[model samples]
Target chain A: MNYLHKELYNLLISDHHIFDFIRESALDGLWYWDVENPENEWMDGKFWTTLGYDPEQMPHKSSAWQDIIHQDDLKVALENFKKHCEDPNHPYDQIVRYKHKNGHTIWVRCRGMAIRDHNGKAIRLLGAHNEVSALKKHEEILKRCNSAASIGYWEIDFISEKVLWSTLTKEILEVERDFTPTINETLAFFSEGKSKTSLLNAYQNAISKGESYELELPISISKEKTKWVKIVGIPQITANKCTQIYGTVQDIDLRKTNELKLREEREKLRISEESFRANFEHAAIGMAILNEKGQWLKVNNKLCEIVGYSQEELRQLTFQDITFPADLDADLVLFQELMDGKRDHYQMEKRYFHKDGHIIYIILAVSIVRNNEGKILYVVSQIIDISELKEAKNKIHSLLKTSQEQNNRLKNFAHIVSHNLRSHSSNIGFMIDLLTNENEKLTEKEEYKLLKTASNNLAQTIQHLNEVAMIQTTLEENLQAISLSNSIKSAIENVAAIADAAQVKIINEIKPDEVILGLPAYIDSIVLNLLTNGIKYRSENVDSYIKISSFHSMQYKVILFEDNGKGIDLEQYGSQLFGMYKTFHRHPEARGIGLFITKSQIEALGGRIEVESEVNKGSKFKIYLKNEKDKKPMYHR
Target chain B: MKKTKSLCIIDDDPIYTFGLKKIIEFGKFDVETIFYENGKEAYENLSQVISDGESLPDLILLDINMPIWNGWKFLDEFTKLLSEPSVVVYIISSSIDPKDREKATEYQIINSFIVKPVSIDKIREILQSN
Candidate 1:
């Protein structure tokens, strides 16, 4: 025994005062009991006082303390005391709960020793008491915190080849409280792929190099469940060798899954943004982004090419700067609508000024982007160059104007030629007639006959020219409303003698009130010519009849003259039917000038004529004239 | 029958006037024929005759295509001067254009329109009608 213990034993045996002094100095609570009597016992005042009790009011029996002790703890204490009395090998130290005077439990650690007689039989029991309620409360708080935080503690001792796991750590690994795991078995809890390999490498490095690591890895909890865990391994080094490694294993499965999902969303957003950038940079049509003030924010390569500017140069300029001055007002008006929230997009054919100072035609489409509050953010514009198309259109317009002017000049020249020619031919014929009349012997001469024939032909040719010139000259003459029936009746009367000689019946089917817009002279001439033609070309096989009718189309008045005559074959004579001097028949009067003059007169009234003819059946001549009654202003002069 | 006692011919073409005078002679019409080169000359000489208190020509043949004054202008001025002309008038021209014929009818002084190269029978018809 140590001197202190021997002195304590000597004080306990020789003097109770010295033992009391020792107890007061070093112990919180002291006790003494008589094992042989089993009832008598002593407890210091401080022991009752620590439990919120007064020693004077307490019982001096062992059962008094027993009744106040926890029932389960009393049973354990009794068993341990019995074992200590029998073999004196088992310890009699235990943490027990005691009821306090305030009705709350107090925690205490009790330690006792048996005082034996010479025969080694138990005589008395002496014990010390330490109140540990604050310590117990702190331990309870730590365990609750670990469980709440899903943090478990673990340690590995390399020298002893031992592994220790806290109660919460065992729970994290999903093992029973009594189950023990070796180093390799503990490592098996990590998932079989990256987690296992990384952990194994980390552990090896820690044991050999005394390095530390903190890693988040996945752990298999069950056949179908995997959990993410954060492990921190800290190696304890002694003399430059690793002797232990210990750290926390935390369950981070929820946090890690949410983090992974957020990263995937970010990656997807990045890819979409990249693709949009690619499309903008390489678009087929010119594209640009502009601010609300019309300043260019970004321009694609195609836009640069169309505007004949570098992207850097364009970005410094506003859209209004490059826009053609005449086209700016229209573009701004539409832009104002977008700003006012009246429209979101607009499209127009607009002009822009190229860098080289030429006008460029473009089809521009603009769309405005707005914020949640409806404020304009920016505008996107798509431009298609149409300069080539505009140039071609302008070229065609000028060509059409030139051709129309030339055609008018040609008509004027033809009229002048016919007028001058007619005068000369008339003089020649008159001289020929005078010669034939004055000198009857000269007409009987063969050469005189030829001269007469030639003179007659010259007059006929001049007459045809005069007829054609009349149409050209009368084109601009004022037209009057003429009664179709009256005009046709007069024409029939004029050709009545010829029709009667040809034995041709004439039928007028026109309504008596039918009226048309034309020069009265032209109407008379056109009707007379058709009447003469019908009589002259009467089919010998049939009773020739000439029918005249009038009808109205959408914008024209149609006059039809149907004749049962030896109709000219249209297929053989269609193109030359209206050509001047193109005689198609051997009739002595088939001068071919009548139909030609008729077609020309119809055209002078802004009309057209069509002929439907069969070789021997009949011919139908339809003349289409403008129906100017309802709409006279367009055809007036 | 009223004889065409005095006749006047206005034309720019000498050949046309000659042929017309020959036809009148061949018709054996007892008429004195006078000739002017154009409408301006005819108007001046006829105005002098009116001013001198001499009788106007019994008939006047006017040509449309002329220099200085066309036939239509002479008729317009002369008709305004004399509201009703005692002399018969005919508009004779080589122009076969219907517009020209239509225009001649607008004048009260005009008696008729005759196409050029007047044949012997046409002249006899005109003299006998007068």
Candidate 2:
């Protein structure tokens, strides 16, 4: 009925082109109504077609629209229309759904103007309609995507003094869902100092110069909560000036914190590398880094000086190239073990050939290096040169050898002098008795007795001295690889008559193939002495059996001579057991020189003799000889 | 005491044996004497005596430091033959070294150790004690 006055709106809007504005974009249909005559209506073809109705079949009256509108939107549409008619100055606008001929509801945007005479009463209505269902669906989709991603968008209208925010922006700021923020309130969410300054400058730049800004900054979301957020602002310029600005905002708290921590770790690794390089260059001892090929990748100054090669020169050679030939094989074997993962590190006293062709005795320590992925990379070798110490040790060794020889010589001389003096004194004692005997006259028989005894004692003493001298100077003896069992057999045969006389049963259990480095004569003498001692010390009650057997340890071949005889108390005579003339038992044949000489012979051949005995049990004499197959003579410890 | 049947002197020195022999006779001990200049000769002859079925001497006087088997080696062989014969061995040597004195104590069959120049009194005492 009001649209009957629309002819008056047409005169003003036709020139002003308000209809063309709607028709160009959002207009789906046009309508005019006469307020005085509600049945008088005009509808465009598209108005019926918008609801899937043929234009001819579609109604042109207001009642027809009322009948076709969905019940949910019909009440609100009628209330809007009635209210606008009361005050024609108010514009008419409603969004409502109408029933289509196909029985589906389609959303329509209806905007109209109520034109009235100067009396301010509704006269006519003019409006444009548009189907807005698809546009609303797109906005819903966009809003859902922003909420899921915690992505927020904001816009500022320069001319309107307006600010707009997506739903996520309000959530990020911890504000109520319906809260509308002014431009000042939005800017205040950034922290008060640096953040405020940067955000303000960026916003002004975007609005005034149409420049874009992207920043990650901290913002205060609440009194106690601060969040890291990324913001991107894109300016919309109109007439060469920014009219509006909009951008996306995303919370970046976790990502930014993790990025900062990763940077710190890289910084710490850089610092460690710096210190390692400093230590390597300034080390006091020689050190070097080697590649898998053992080529010098880096050498410290000390290493260069030790090897008498410049850094450039050393880099051209491998570790094996400069090692002494005598020591290279051993050093390389240990090095190869490191590369093969069989060992983590190794150290050895090895000799290196210096640039001057002299040997440098160095203790080399090498350690393995691996990559982050656990692949073998290189090795670090530290060398400590010790040639001076080696020189001093060798000097001491030779000095000790000389002193030991001197001590043995002096001991032999003393024994010979004592023997000579004893023999001479005995002869004189006999002569004095012969010349002045109370029981008989000084006759020719007595004179001849003194003369013969004196001469014989002198001659025998000379022979014994020679034997002592020979045994003392063991250097004069010939050494060879003699079978221990064969030597004992020959010695047994030498004393066979004595053993036979004493009824000594000798059990030679020595392994026939067991050989040792020894002086054949000394072995024979040693075996002979032990056999005689066993026979001489036999207990009258027991059947004596002398058992000779062989055993060995890591370093020495041993022959054990055990006897069931009147064994001496070794604990009481241990100190003097091998002393010349120091006899422990009460036996006429224990001249004692047998054990003394045997011990001397064993020591001279780099062997040792030990005795264990109980008073009534037996005696066991163990002779240990070095098994020197490599031809390096081993001495008694 | 029992009177000794026979005595043996094993010494390389003839004069020492002669002086010992004279003292035994002078003491009126009524003992026969056998003499060998060295241990080897005494050992061989003693073994021969055993083989011949002759009785071993009651007492044997031995000397040390002899050639061809000293007193030590001789005792080593001689003691084997003495198990059946109750021979009392005495070591009489002129060398007064303590070594000889100590060594003479090793043999159980050796009854005494006497130094050189055996006295007439010592010989009488030995005979009286046995």
Candidate 3:
């Protein structure tokens, strides 16, 4: 030190160039100050240049450096200098910032020493500056990177039994920078159970065994806020003993929460898939999945049973291959419509060729599966076997046809009976007429009178049979729209003589606009027969009157034939009034065939006959006929 | 009334024909009566008489529902043979069926449709009308 001091003093008084060259090469700059005269100081040229200023433009004075120095850094330097002067053992070294001539900060390592005269009075001060701005900039970048990545450092010093937290670690724990927690307090940030235990074990291993560990653990920042963190501990071992344990704590809450949700979704999807599989396997009806080209991609056991094929066999064939030719086209048309996006699903009764070669009838329902873009993925078909039902329906149809044929034959036989009886009755009448005209004595005989009566009875019976047969043979197709009032008028005209003789007045009250659909002949017969019946059954005690009126029912045009005469006892004869050969009255003209025929005629026109009568007050016969404006079609008897 | 020179009766029922003939005779008309059992027989004999250029009966009674050919079938064929027949014809039927009465009106040759059990008075009226 004496030799270097001798050389530096020799250079300072002799060749000053070498001393200045050594200062420029060894340090950023050097300074000298006169303590007694505080403003008097000298700064080397390198200091000004380091601050982005030309040395010749800077003054060689203390104030020149102080003006460019950071205000906070200047105070630190001054304090350090005062301590150093009071006790030379104290180092006057620190990092200080200076403003560059370009308006940017320049960081420098500044050191100073106080030179004192005899009796410890400081006379001069010397200082050195070294630029460290680039290194400082790099440290700032790393600090920002750690905060951006949500990573923070923590340390446990075993020797001092102290815990240290970085600024970001304090931020993550929601603590103030002044908070200095004990080691146990730091461990309290871990969750109460598994998280705390796991971290404690990892910390113990790190301290005792010098083991490094990484763990994802749950931690609580406050009473209500919880987070998941990836905590890692790396041990620093010295002399085979851990001196410190330090690592990083990273926030992983977002990733772990998403992972948990994904797992739950996967579990739910798996359960749904299992249930769907069970349903598909155990379904009652046949089910199948097929490609758009009609190829079977899958078939359930029920489907195989319905088609008389195995599942594997069905998968080898397309629907078109097994479909009955006659029904295939219709099925294809509907399927095409589904594929063309015209329909979402379809149902049709179709026939298929069974594996055993017989035709099988089925009701097939089909729907499509589609991708998100609306392209068809596949087709799902449900089939129900209907062959047995079809067979039963055919049997019923044939049975109905057979019954209809038998009924027609019976009606024809009735006609034949009437025709044959009429011929024989005509012969009998002729014989009776001849016998009576030829011999008066023969006609006077009791036997001859009896024979005439028999013949008359035979004629009447034949007439009744003919009338019944005519009603049966009448076809609904022969019905015409006949005015009700006109028919009643004509019937009244025909019965005028008889009605007048009996003192029975027949008043036609039917409106002229009322029309009915019926056979013209049958309508006339019914009206006339009712008119005669009203007159024939007239009470001898009162003035007999017959009234005809028309109205409408649900599907029928009703004509009411009311009479003020010796009415029938409805309770006694109501059920038998419309029966053939039924006799209710003692009148000779009560053949008992009129009401029966009328009822049959009404029924043949898709109508009915209803009667209401009292013993002596009056009788009402309501005849229903098909209404011309009604929607019901005429029905044949 | 013009006296009927000849009368023809076509009926399948012998009793009906006999009674009708007896009535015509009892009326004391000087008319010669001819009878045929069915429409076919009457048609053949009448067509022959007309082709032979002989006069037909003044009045002819045709019965429907006969054997071999019905009254309607005979009328159809007989009318084609004669343009305007001079004979007055009547349809006699035992059938009370109104359909037969309505069908008889379709033939221009038929003067009237009469139901069976015709009274002697009706026969007398027919004879005088003829």
Candidate 4:
């Protein structure tokens, strides 16, 4: 008996050590309740402490413990405990909040087992209470965060094929808490077509392979509208078989829509840029892009052709290198205005240097490119070659000048003709008046002389007018090569009889090989007129002496005819020397039409005749003709 | 017929002047003839006469083209004279330019614009009309 008592004490000692170990570890608390005697229920000190009460002030019966439980949780906890008491093999587990002595509530997980007699009827209940206050607080925080972030959690049961969704998950689907949805029904809530197919495939893959999947898909919550969601699913695997899929679903509709809009805008910008490049490269007019420093940034093929430079060469050159010196200042001023943001475009008539060292006139239009912030980027220039237009304008100007000069000449000719014809006709009228007034008083000889002089003067004036008309009309044809020496000799020979009668000396200094381009008849008339004038105006005191000389100019063959004769005052007759019917001397042969005819003939052949004279000195007439091939001609008798 | 009180011949041609003077003298026209070589001399003399309160010429035979102040300028100045006299002007011009004829017709004071070589019959007609 003493040995048994010692052994029993050792067993009690080991049991005490085991209980002490549990208390120190704070693993769990134990409690005992007598179901047969309802008033004798007791909780361990650790169990009372887990429920936030002292063991000395612990609740004594089940009713006392039940009174401290939360009113909403008391019924559930008591029912579970009764079931555990009836079935001894079953354990009861529940989470409940109980009030502490300090007036605060604490969360505890209660687990109990039934202690039964030999017939399997439970006599007492043993249980443990674990304080889960910290775990409850952490779970509350997680729930709050999920609701605020619009994130919801869901679980799918693999064996039962049932879906369990948290309250927040139901809110994300815009459904009620009682709504139970299958996997297909859940996929149906996703937008139809590609989004639904993609989500269904991802779900199927996660269930079969226990794979994790994250997808953003559009979801149609009801018939009217749709929204975007980001779904992440992680399969739970046990024994290499998927038991369930747990996932998070978040509403991301706003961000997805914004991303789509941004993509569309980018596509539009790319198309616009392509069109701009095509227009700039293929334009018909010469175009160039220039940097702010006037360096060529880009040059098109047309610009290359205009400047006679390759694109590569032009890129290395500044605008100043090609700009004409005269147009540079004006171009720079307009460019400065563009840079200053005062103007967007400018146009000017300017000149550029051609590669071949010629000036190219152009009408240039320039526009400045700027960014949204109004900073100048570069200059775009369009150049139109206008050199041909300028040349045509110059030609028209010269033509106008020639026409004006011709009009003036025609006016003067008309005036002179009127004056000459009127004078002659008026003289005839006077003579007729005199004859009529003296019809009975005139003798036959005197009347005959008067009639003869009148008839002779009329015939002479008519012949002189005919000669003037002939000279004006006949020399319209272009000049041809004619022998100058032969022409001079022929002219002198024609007047040899008159010269010999006047004892005139003819001196010829003409080069025998000299030739000129002039009308044949014009040369003859010019030579004859000068020779006859010199002989007619011969000085009364001295015998006539004439000098004829010829020479060649750079573009003309010149002939000079000078005579020592009765030279008239040049200042009085210089302007009228070639005027018709203008007589300086009172000689009978001085009809004043000779020099006029000579001048007209010379001018018709594009030649010029000028005279220099002094009173009683010599009159020198210089005639210029175009230089032509030297031709030897047959002399005429 | 009442002879003109004062007759003036403004011409640049000497022959025309001489012939006119001879005809006036031979016909015994009761008129004192005044001759000027050009419009400038005629304008000066006529203006001087008007300033001295003398009678203006009754008839003026004017030539168109002259060295200084042609017939058109003479008429422009002559119309401004203060003296009141019955005057008849005949423009005797050798110019065949139609523009000159048109210009002469534009003047309200010109009695007749005739071509050159004035005939005795025309002159008689003009004198009888006056």
Candidate 5:
């Protein structure tokens, strides 16, 4: 009993100041109990004072602790205390909650130690309770932060080459909760490709060089499972050497996949824009892009060259500034229609004034580009240079007019000669008749005979002139379809006496079914003239003959007259052979009028006559005439 | 045969006039002859005769193409001064153009159209028909 009292009395009186100092220093509340004397329980003054109460207002007895203890913690408190009192080796150390004077539950770490006698039975219990609610709250917040961020901490020991992963880190690696990993095994979780290589390098740099690194990479944790993680590693150096590497491994798979998708989309957009720019620049035709205000937004090199302006110079001007005044209104109407969305595209031939103030004809095809919501964005214009084509068209028009004027002059010549010839022939005939009546007064009748011969020659000249006039004015008469074979037969019969006198053989091979559209009289005149001319030029050495045949070609019916005649030298006199007053042969009867009239008649009837002759060889006169059965009449005259 | 008081011929060709004069004299038609080288000379002389109220020619021959103020233009001025009821005008030209013939026929006072180089027989027939 004295030993027990000495422990208490000495602790309270001799070292009572030390006991008070320990109670004040170590805990917010303190208590002691004498188990043999249950009535001798004492609660420290701080026990009540820590709860914002004066010791006088609260009982100093240990029985008062039951009321102050939380109701929920009372049963636990009594059981733990009794167990500690019954056993000397057992310690009472636990966390419990207590009710504050303000009716709030306070979390405290409570520790109790028991003192026992020689019998090895606990006699007194002494305990300390310290409030730890704020610390525990901070620990809870840290756990929440880890879960939200998907962050897990890991550490690698250099000595043992072993790895320690937090509970969240194990979850990230898709491993079991009880699993322990080696440094090599943890590195195996990274993919075997580029990510693995990079991860290995980063791990080596962190451990060997005291370097810190952060990387996001793809990692394969299990079979058929891949994830992306952001790793941040920092080195811990000891004694100027790296001894540990530790970092966080965050699951960033969703964010990284989305970032990759965004980058790929941006790359595609860049490629398409490059392609559009390239096509516009290298196009063979001029191309331009203009904004809604007709301002040049983009112009290709071809357009700049056509307008004779540099890109910088052209950027300051609108489309209207370069357009020729005459074509502006028409082009504007189309442009306005496009702006109003009434028309999507328009094409027109418009002119532009080059920088040098010269005209350039262009065919413009323009279209409006619109946004997805149908708002006008820009105008895409294409230009084709047609200045050369326009020049060619103008040249052709002038040539046609000149040719028409020549035709009119020929008609005029025909008209004037018709009247002049008739007048001359009539005068000669009248003079001849008057001279014949005065024959009695003349001494030489031969003089009168010479005058008569002059009149007869004048009549012959008039007849030839009439024949030319008929060819020229054939268009004024009705053109009728005639049978070529019948015409040839008639011409042959008409010249039968002459052919027979010359002993000429006529071989006619023209088909009876073949037909042509021509004036009847002109056809007879043409055939008769050819036959007579052939007879007139018949070869003296060989048996004279004329072979006539007709056949159809693609666009014309060709009539061939092959003759065994004394063919003239066409190389020397070829051009003049069909010319009026151009006689080739020395025969007195050879009048050049025949071929000239024949050519004119053939041309007027929409046919062409070509003579192929070699000095001694036969002459083949090829006449290409229209085959009326296949198509409409080409030439009325 | 009908007798004519006066016959007038307007032509630029002297040969045609000489032949017509010989034919008329040979055929013995009773008519007076008057001559003009072109429409201008004939129009002036005839306009004086009409203004003086003198007797007009019974027949007039007009040529189409002349040196000055040809037949068509002369007709425009002469038609306004038309007062003689017995005078008949005939267009004498060598043109075979149908358009000329149609245009000459439009004048109501024109008797007929005749091609030049007049013969004796045609002169007698013209005198008899008139």
Candidate 6:
């Protein structure tokens, strides 16, 4: 019977190997202590091993474990263990450090329970020790991640409805470390309106349904300061009921600021586009957008008005199509450079074909539009129609030409005046010199002849200058309608004796009804000069024949005077035939003034005179006079 | 100083030429006078005399305004005929233009530019100075 009882006890002990197997696999140590006697303790070999000790060398006593306990944790571990021994029902749990065999400390977690007799006297304590060094290192890693990410954890007790904040959470909120806030007080820290409401709803939903949620919300930790945070809420469930709410809170203020700045930049771009549109549409100068082919992409009202083309029509045609042919190649070359990105802008004075097919000069300034990468987008052309300015310029050129011609005439007149005046004055000086100088022994008749010649030259020069001045100042109102036949007859009658002496026969073929608009005295002078010239310059070896005739032609009364005399060399004197003091013939009676006065008088009456002659042939003078009806047709008729 | 042996007047104006000739003759300046109508005729006659190895006129009165080959052009051609620069030249002209006087001064062969009408006293002074 004694042998059987010892065997039963061994069976009971070996059956407990399952617990030993679990402790060994979990890397835990097992221990037992006698509460009835303060010195009785039992430590598994694994416990000594965890403390870096050999159990075979150590005695089994409470002092053996007490000797390895860390000094700072010994008191707290002993007090908690004493409480567990005294109550016999209290849960025993503690985290403490044990000294290693190498003199360094190792972290450990101890859990234990009290064993009592039927009378409730505590007999022993059973516990397990976990070498929590790796777990502690893992916890430190999690804490560092949270701090680096600016993330903090939060918890809410469902039963107490109170919120608990971690150290990082308190730091993020800029709150005191010891401050414990209720759920309502924590919600009050959120922004007053939509943020607070959304956060409360999410929190309540998480607590009720054991759901997890994430929200980005703006929270105001103080009266005036606000920050953006990402809130992640997870509910803790036990028996399928939510007991606690816990989540992470991340400060996202920097990201939120960047987003807001991006939105403001977008709004500024929109405003810039609006301003560009307004300027393009309402600019005073003509503006247009053209494609690479020079076709108008868009045109403003000013452009349409300038080209006299409708917007639709302008868009349908390229600029080259409407440009004047002369200006096409030059404008095209500049446009090609713009397309190649060689030039940013080009300006030129160009001509375009208007709607009416006339060339209109314009000053065009064109700029190339480019994308960010320097690709040509389109061309913006500004056209300034300078047609009127061009016209005025042309007018000025014509005026300059006329002014140059008039200046040349004035120079010629000055030369002629100088020559005539000098000849007469020099003659007078010669006469005086001859009369006073005792060295020159002049005869009386010779002296008288020289004096007479000087006087005649002086008088002729004065008379010719007076005639020029008279013609210049005479008004158009001084002209009148004079009978052509009567003027010719009177002139012929004045030179009758000279005509008879020269054996010149005058034939009057002038129509009695023919009349011309002229100054009467000027008409008399012109006819008298011509007739006398015909008789005075008569051929010395031949009979002189003078035939005069007048006829009515279109818009003029034409008078023809034909004289059979030595004709002039028209080619040699054609340009200066009527020039003042220009004499082609060397006749003694040729003062070189008759034709000059005749030409001036005819011009003053708005008529013209032309001569037809050859070197040896007779000469014909065709005088064109304004017909009476042609002068003021409506009034005269 | 010796009086000039012979003097020549080349002018188109007959009255001025005749007056000048009489003044030179009556001055008893001991000079035979020669006359020509224009510069062309005068240059031809003078060139012929020089080519024949005859002595040129001691003094020449050249007129500026003439029908053909006036005084300035004549002087340009006349200098080529004679190597000696001793013959005195006097320019007589009715032109009061300053440019003419300036032009006359540019010719080194010309002695003086005189404004016509040429007086006997001015001629007398020129002869005496020469």
Give TM per candidate: 0.53, 0.56, 0.62, 0.57, 0.58, 0.55
Kindly report which residue stretches of model 3 are placed more than 4 angstroms away from their true locations once superposed. Answer: A1-361, A366-379, A385-392, A414-419, A472-481, A500-513, A538-557, A562-574, A613-619, A631-637, B1-4, B38-40
Model 6 per-residue lDDT tens digits across residues B10-113: 88888887777777766667677899888889889999998898888878889887888888888888898878786899998776555678899899989998
Q: What is the DockQ of each candidate?
A: 0.43, 0.13, 0.44, 0.22, 0.23, 0.21
- The reply for model 5, stretches above 4 Å from the true place, is A1-195, A216-406, A437-494, A515-526, A551-554, A601-607, A626-637, B1-130
Which structure among the candidates has the greatest lDDT?
1
Top candidate, metric TM-score: 3
Candidate lDDT scores, in order, read: 0.86, 0.80, 0.86, 0.81, 0.82, 0.82
lDDT of 1 by residue, A212-327 (tens): 99999889988898888899999999999888999998888899999999999999999998997899999999999999889999999998999899999998999999999989
- If candidate 6 were superposed on the true structure by all CA atoms, what would the RMSD be? 21.4
What does the lDDT come to for candidate 2? 0.80
What is the CAPRI rating of model 5's predicted complex? acceptable
- Quote the positional error of residue A244 for candidate 6 in Å: 8.7
Share of native C-alpha contacts between chains A and B (below 8 angstroms) recovered by candidate 2: 0.27
State the local distance difference test value for candidate 5.
Answer: 0.82
RMSD of 1: 11.8
- Error (Å) of candidate 6 at residue A223 is 8.8
Model 3 agreement with the true structure over B23-95: per-residue lDDT tens digits: 7666676788898888788889989988999888888888888899988888888888887877788987787
Q: Write the per-residue lDDT of candidate 5 for residues A1-637, one digit (tens) a residue.
A: 7898778877787766877787798888887778788667777777777666787876656676677677767677678878877875566877787777888767788888887888868788787878787887786687678879999989988877778998899898889999998877887787678998998898788877888999999899777989999999999999988888888999999999899999999999999989988989999899999988888888999999899999988889999999999999999999999999999999999999999999999999999999999998899999999999999999999999998898788677666665766676777677566554445565367777777777767666666766676565345234566788898988999999999999999999988876887778678888888999899999889899999998877888888989989897988999898988799889978868899998999888877899999776679998887676744546745
Task: List iRMS for all predictions.
Answer: 1.5, 5.2, 1.4, 3.6, 2.5, 4.1
Mind sharing the TM-score for model 3? 0.62
- CAPRI tier of model 3: acceptable
Per-residue lDDT tens digits of candidate 5, residues B18-87? 7777766666678889988888888899899989989778788888877888888778778878854467
RMSD of each: 11.8, 16.8, 9.0, 21.8, 10.6, 21.4
Candidate 3 residue-wise lDDT at A577: 85
Tell me which of candidates 3 and 4 scores higher on DockQ. 3
Candidate 6: give the TM-score of chain A.
0.49
Across A305-382, the per-residue lDDT of candidate 3 in tens digits comes to 988999889999999999999999999999999999999899999999999999999999999999999999989999
